[model samples]
Target: MDRSPFPHHGPLRPEQVTGRESLAVDLAQRIADRRLTALVGPRRFGKTSLLKRVAADLAAVGPQPVWIDLYQLTSMADFAAAVDRGLASVVGPVRRALDSIAATVALRIGVLGVELTRSPKYRPDPVLSLRNLLGVLTSAAQRHDLFVVFDEFSGVANIQGGAGVLRTELQHHFQSLGIVFAGSEPSTMRALFSEQTQPFFAQADLVEIGPLSDAAVGHIVEDGFETTQRHTGGITSRIVAFAAGHPQRAMQLADALWRRVEPGETADMPAWEAALAEVRTNVNAASERIFSLLPTGQQKTLRAIAAGGSIYGAAASALELPPGSAQDAAEKLIGNGIVRRAQERLEVIDPLLADWLCRRFPI
Candidate 1:
C-alpha cells in the first residue's frame, strides 16, 4: 500500500478511482459520433474532472480533444484568445485548417508579433473567427474527428449576457463538430439546450453527471488512500455522508482524513470530526458571503427554505412571500451556483453551505 497523498485539485486521471466510468464511456461515444453533449451538476460535483477524463479518453481514440475553461475568460476577446491557445495545441489536419484561416484573415498575434504561425490574435468578435476556424478544422479533420470541450460554459453565457443568444450562435457554428459543454448549474444548462425558446433547444444530448455510488466511493478510498485496512466501506460511507454526494467535497474530506491518520492506523471518529469541521468552516464562510449579497426579501426566503427543510413551499407559508419572488430568487441563486433544485426540493448546492446556513439561522 503506497502512502501517498491524493491531489486536492486539478483533473483526475484514469488511474484514479473516482467511479465515473459510465459517464466517461457515454461522453466518449457521443464525441466519437460527432454529437453534442452537455454535462450538468452542482459545483464540486466533479463536472470538470469527469470531462477531463472523458476528453483524455477521446483523444486517445484519435480525435484530438481540446479543453477550454470558460471561467478564465471574461470578455469575448479573452474567450477567443483562450480558444486560440487551446486550438494551437492541436495538430494534423485540424492544425492546417486553422493555419489556413489565419493566413486568409491576416490574423495577427498579440504584441509578441509572433504572427499566426500557431496562435491567432484574440479578436473581440471571436465567434465569427471561431466559426471559420472550426469550419476548416472540421473539414480538414473530417476523417479523424476533433473534440472540443467547453467547461464552465454557464460562466461563458453570463459573460455574453445570458446563454440564450450565445448558445444559439455556438450551436449553429460548432454543433456539427464534436463538442461537449459542461457546467455545474443544471438549470442554466437545461435552459440553454432543453428549452425550446432557447437557441440550442434539443441540439445536444443532456447528460447528468451524478454522485459516485457507495461501492465506488469505497474503491476510491481503498485505492486512492492506499490502505488495505478493510474498513474502506465504512470510511467511504462516512465521506459520502459528509459530502452529500458532491465529488469534490467527498475527495476533500477523504484527503483531509487520510492526512490526519498515521500510517498503519485506521481512521477514527476524531479524525473524521476534525475533517468535517474543516469542511464546514470553509463552506460557512462562502455561504456567509453569498448570503450577505442577497436582498432582504431573498435572504428571508432562503431562511424560510432552510427552516422548512427545503424551498418547496417555504415562500408561500413560512415567508408569506409571493411565489414569483421565491422562484426568481431561486433561479438567480441557481445561476450563481449557490443553490439548486433537486429531488423536488430546493437547497444549497453545497452540503456544507446548507450546514452553514442552518447554523446561522436556526429554526
Candidate 2:
C-alpha cells in the first residue's frame, strides 16, 4: 500500500518538514543564547512542527528539550501534571533533581508511573508546585541548557494565579534556562504578553509565524506527488493558488489528491475538484461554527473579505454593508487573527474558511 506523503496531523520532524529553514535556524540560535522567546501564531499554523525542528537543531549540540502542552489544563494541579509529563523525558542529573523535589512534595509514583504530585500541605500555595517543578528544571539548566517549550500557553490564564507564579519564577531563571512560550489564540496571547497589566507583560521576545511562501507550498505539493511516483499533471499550481501557503491546507489538499490518484496515475483537474470537495466537506462544520459565533458586522466582514478585492469599498457595497461598518469589522477581525492585510487588501487568514464562505454565499 502506498501511503500519503503529506502529513497534516501532529508535529513533523525537522528533516521531514519544509518551508521553515530560516525560522528554525534563527529560533535555535536565540534559544541557544538562553533567550526567553514567545512564538505567536494562529491555530493549525504548524507552530509545533517548527518547535520540533528547533528542538532537533538544538539537541545536536546541547540543550535538552522539555515540551508541555497546556491546552486543556483548567487548574494549577493540572499544570503541575502537565509539567511532570514534560519532565518525564529528562534523565541523568536533572531526573535526579526532579526526584529530590518529588520526595519533598510527597510525589507518588502511581501505577501509571507519572511522578508529578502536590502535597496536601502545599496545595493551598496556588501554583507553587509548578514553581517547584520549574525551579528544578531551571536549577538543572545552570549546568546544561534546558529548552522548555510551553505550547498553548495562553491557557495559563485559566488557572487562578498560574501566570503570576510563572512570571515571578521566570524572572529569576532568565539567565539559567532557555524558554519558548507558544499559543494559538492571537488575542489571548497578545493580552498575556503585550498588556502592561498582565503578569507576562514584556517577559519574552515575540516571534510571529504566518502562512508558508508560494515556493514552499509548491515544493510540498510537487515533491509529494513526485516522491510517490505520481504525476501532478500541472495541478500543483492550482493547489498552490488555492492553498495560498497555509501549511495545513496545502497538505490536506495534497493528501486528498494523492488518494484520488492511483499508483502511476496522473493528477488532473477532476482530481483537484474532488479533493477540494472532500476538504470543504470536512471543514464545513468548523467554518460554520466560527461564522455563527461572530457578531453580525464581523460575519458580514468575513463574507466581504472572502469575496476579495477592496473589502471596505466594492465588496462591502455588494454585501449591503456601510463602508465604515465593514472597515471597523475588518480591523477587529485582523486584531483577532481571523483576517490579515496583504498588499493593501484584507484577506481571510484561513484559506478553507474563505473558500467555505465563497461556496456557501456567492459574492
Candidate 3:
C-alpha cells in the first residue's frame, strides 16, 4: 500500500510471500552447512532475488554475506577486482578479515590513483586474488562462518574458459566458505556445472527455480496495488497471465501499470495492453540486435523454423538452406541461449522474445 509498484531492490525475502520461501529456506540450509549451491532459472524468474534473500538470512546467523554479479565482469582480472571491491565493502569483522589480504594484494580502486582507504591494490588475476582472499575468509569463517553469493554466474562463461578453471579452483581451495551461484541462463549454467567435461560437474547442488504459482503471483500483485486502492481483479490476473509466472516480467509489468494509473483511478485494460506493447517493443529491439549478429543462412534457418513452428525437416526445404545448416543453426541458437529446444520443437526462450522473433522474421 505504498503507492509504488516496484518491489524492493536486490532480492525478495523469504517472508515476502512471493511464493519462493520453500526454495529460499532450502538454499539457506545448504549455505549454512558450507555447501556450494547453483540456482538456475530463466531470466527474471527470481533466481538472483532468491539468492539475495538467502544471503541476508545467512548473514543474520553469523558469517558476513558478500554478493557479486559476474555479468559486470569481462575477464578474470575484472572478476578478481570486483571480488576485492565487494569484500572491501564489508564492515566490522569481515572488513578486518580482508585487511591483511588487501595489504598484501595492494588492491587499488581504478586506473586513476584511487586506493581503498583500508583496502589493497587491485590484483591482475581475479581467480588467484579471490583464492588468496578466500584463504583469509576461510580463516575468518572458522570464527565467523561467511557466506558468499555469486549472481549472474552464467557470465563466467564469457571469461574465456575461466569459468571452468575458477570453479575447479574454488572447489578445491574454498570448500569451507559458503558459496551460492545464481544465474538467469539455467541451461548454460547446467552445462558448466553438470556436464562431465566441465570442472564443476556434480560439485554443487543444483536448484532450478520455476514460475510462481497463481496464488503467489496474485499476492504480489494485490499487495503491490493495495497502496493505490486498486482491487485485485481481471487487470491483475491478465498481467500475471501475460508474464507467465516470470518474476522479473511480473514485477516489471506491475511497475509499468502502476505508473499508468492516474491518481485516484484504478488501472484498466488499456493500461495493461499499453504495458504489454511496450514490453514487446523492448524485446523486439533486443532480439533484432542478436539476430543481426547471425549469418544470413542462420537467419533464414531461424525464420524457416519459426514459420514451420518446429525445427524438424519439414521446414528445411522451404528455407532453401541445407538441412544440416538449419540443424546446426538451431544448435547454435540453443547454445547461445537465444533459443530453446524441447520435445524436438524450437522456440525463443521468453514469450516476449518469441513475439519479437515472430514480428521481425515474419515467417
lDDT, candidates in the order shown: 0.66, 0.81, 0.68
lDDT by residue for model 2 over 1-363, one digit each (tens)?
887899888777677788988888888888888787889887778999999888877877778788878987787877877776777766766567666656676653121123334464534343655776777666667766677899989888788878887778778877778889998877778888889988888878889988899999998888888999998999999888988888888899999999999889999988999999999999999999999999999998888778775755567787688988888888889877888777777889889999999999884
Q: What is the RMSD of candidate 1?
A: 4.4
Which runs in model 2 stand beyond 4 Å of their true positions? Answer: 91-93, 104-126, 309-325
Residue-level lDDT of model 1, residues 1-363, one tens digit each, is: 444445657666655635888777888888878788888877667778777777677666676776666775565555555566666766666566656656676553231122223334442355554444444445544444667888887666555643443454455446456788888766777777877776677987888877667677666667665643423425667876656666676777787778776666777788888978887876676788878999876787677656545444644556666777777777777676676666787766666666777788887
Residue 7 of model 1: what lDDT? 60
Q: Flag regions of model 3 displaced more than 4 Å.
A: 1-3, 7-17, 100-128, 160-169, 172-175, 186-188, 195-197, 296-308, 321-324, 341-345, 361-363
The true-versus-predicted C-alpha distance at residue 21 of model 1, in Å, is 1.8
Top candidate (TM-score): 2
TM per model?
A: 0.81, 0.90, 0.80
Q: C-alpha displacement of 101 in model 2, angstroms?
A: 4.6
Candidate with the larger lDDT of 1 and 3:
3
- RMSD in angstroms, candidate 3? 4.3
